[model samples]
Target chain A: QQQVKQSPQSLIVQKGGISIINCAYENTAFDYFPWYQQFPGKGPALLIAIRPDVSEKKEGRFTISFNKSAKQFSLHIMDSQPGDSATYFCAASRTFGNEKLTFGTGTRLTIIP
Target chain B: DTAVSQTPKYLVTQMGNDKSIKCEQNLGHDTMYWYKQDSKKFLKIMFSYNNKELIINETVPNRFSPKSPDKAHLNLHINSLELGDSAVYFCASSRGLAGVRQETQYFGPGTRLLVL
Candidate 1:
């Protein structure tokens, strides 16, 4: 299946708190996993991504944890702020030649001020 | 300038009408894709084009067709549109068509279709 399942359809966190979103995939052929952040009335933008070769990737305040055997990955946002409030989607793509992505349902994260 | 751009950000039409949404990507990427997000917030791939050629066409209705005039543009044309066709459609692109999943995809702001 092309589906990348995500958990916690919505999330609420306080400012300075940690925000976490989880995703799982069914297609083992998928080689690339990416996370997207989208604000209201905006398109989804790349937040963070990881490959099966590496177990984790950290970019500034955002980090992605990947587990190839589990076929799962997660995005962790540290020091979450109100500006970080938005929808986050986890996606997977075969990418070896076909760079098409299969997106998750999306998680609406609201960081309370 | 926007990396990926689309026309008619919002479209409202009556049932049985025909509509088309045009998308253009300026990122000079080699691959382009179309995704549909429903009211439930579920985003699914509809079609994909590479170098003005069809690469992927999901199990979408025959009423829906995609046309690629060039490497920078992909347009979706729906004939005899139905109420069920209402959703937000997004266009996206990536740099390389064949890689080990290294390049990141750039997404366009999305076209919301409201079929009345």
Candidate 2:
């Protein structure tokens, strides 16, 4: 299965709070998982990525927790700010094959002050 | 400087008309790709090219064609465009074709095409 299912089609969080989004994949062949952030009228940009070997990755205030056995991954934003509001998408891909990233349905996150 | 650039950011056309969207990457990447984002916000990969060689071609219609003149450029051409063809087309590129260990792809601003 090439599909990557993402939950909470939309999320609302208050400033200084934490916002989390989860995703799951059926394709075990996927070795690379990445999250993308897209602002209105712009292209999706890579936010954070993780490999199966690592269970967690933290970059600044953004963290990605990955589960190998469960085939799940999540994105956590600490101290959520209004600027962080955007559409987040989870994607998966195998490096050796076609190297095409299978994207999720995307989650629209709103950070309210 | 812009890493990936696309021409005709917005295209509005009538049915049966043909159109082409051009993409170029200044990142000197070896691989490039074309994606279509439908109204539902689903980003689907249409084609990918590595070093001017076609690598991946999704289950797109025959009316759509992708041409890569060189490693820096990949253009998409559509024939007999239909109403369903209206969507945002994005062009992206990576340093290499290997994804497991490749750098994040650089994406263009995207070209929105409206077919009437």
Candidate 3:
């Protein structure tokens, strides 16, 4: 079963526009939610992360809005640029010592100038 | 310097052959992970090691084996390779185990394997 589900397998946005990707989870045990960005031929890197206690967290132009009650979260990129074109993955995990991250099906984001 | 490094960035082999991929981290992390990403871009955990000890082992095939010579190195050995095993493999490391205050993971450039 897919514990975490992401929507819009692909996305396109003009430069300086806002880009958004959404994800939903079924496991209530999940407490940590993180977003990763990957460029072609490279490994995925950490972009932003949020906990269930926070409604939102922002880092630079990247923001993560999390709703614990709805078991949903979304990533918003303000002023999206051509450099922002990459694949994004949303993941969830419990706060255990050795928990493995459960990842959502990824979204390919494209920022056109 | 790369934080995490994987050798043999690309591998191509015929079916029934055996191969191994090596991973190393210089960040002095205590945990390492192996993930497989399919053509559809779905990533799944295959194994995890913490302090050179196996911690998470997912429902992967028996043909796959993970060896941790030390905390900084983890190797994957595949036997009797099959066409279905063709995919990109990623190695990652963290300062501590997953879910420990949401430790950020550092990933190495993936290894693309093609089995015919």
Candidate 4:
């Protein structure tokens, strides 16, 4: 079973536009939600993360809006640039236990100038 | 310095051949993990080791085995490689123990394996 589900397998946005990707989770035990960005031929890197306690988190132009009640979260990139063109993955994991991450399928984001 | 590194950035082998991929971390982390990203870019955890001890072993095949020589090194050995095994394998490490919450995981550049 896919504990974490992501929508829009691919996305395209013009430069300076807002790019959004959404993800939903089925496990309520998940407390840590993180987003990873990966470029071609490289491994995924941590972009931003949020906890259940926070409704939203902003790091520069990147923002993560989390809704614990709905078991959903979304990533918003303001002023999306060509440099931001990469694959984005949303992951969830519990604070305790094995703490293994459950990742979404992934979304390939393209920023066109 | 590279936080995490893997050997043979690209591996092309024939089916039924046995192959291995090595991973090492220099971030003084105690936990290491192996994740496979398929063609569709779906990333899944295969195994995890904490302090040279096995912790998380997902529903992977027996042909795939993970050995941790020490907290800094984790190696993956695959027997009888198949075409389905063609994907990019990533190694990651975190600071805390397996049971503890370590949110940040540093990943390697990834080893792209192609089984012909």
Candidates 1 and 3 compared: the better one by lDDT is: 3
Q: RMSD per prediction, one decimal?
A: 1.3, 1.2, 1.2, 1.0
lDDT of 1 by residue, A1-113 (tens): 87789988999999999999999999988988889998887789998888888998999999999988888999999999999999999999876776568889999999998
- DockQ of every candidate structure: 0.66, 0.60, 0.69, 0.75
Each candidate structure's TM-score, on Cα atoms with residue i matched to residue i, is 0.96, 0.97, 0.97, 0.98
lDDT of 1 at A51: 80
- Residue-by-residue lDDT tens digits, candidate 2, B17-114: 99999999999899999999999888889999999999989999989999999999999999999999999999999886544365687789999999
Question: Once superposed on the true structure, which residue ranges of model 4 sit more than 4 Å away at CA?
Answer: none
Give Cα distance to truth, residue A113, candidate 3, Å: 1.3
lDDT of 3 by residue, B1-116 (tens): 99999989999999999999999999999999999999999999999999999998999999999999999999999999999999999999997764566488899999999999
Candidate 2, clashing residue pairs?
Answer: A95-B100
Higher-lDDT candidate of 2 and 3: 3
lDDT, model 4, position A47:
98
**What class would a CAPRI assessor give candidate 1's docking?**
medium
Is candidate 1 or 4 superior in lDDT?
4
Candidate 3, lDDT over the whole model: 0.94
Model 1 residue runs over 4 Å out of place are B99-102
How much lDDT does candidate 4 score? 0.94
State which candidate has the highest DockQ: 4
Give chain B TM-scores in order.
0.94, 0.95, 0.96, 0.97
Stretches of candidate 3 exceeding 4 Å from the true structure: none
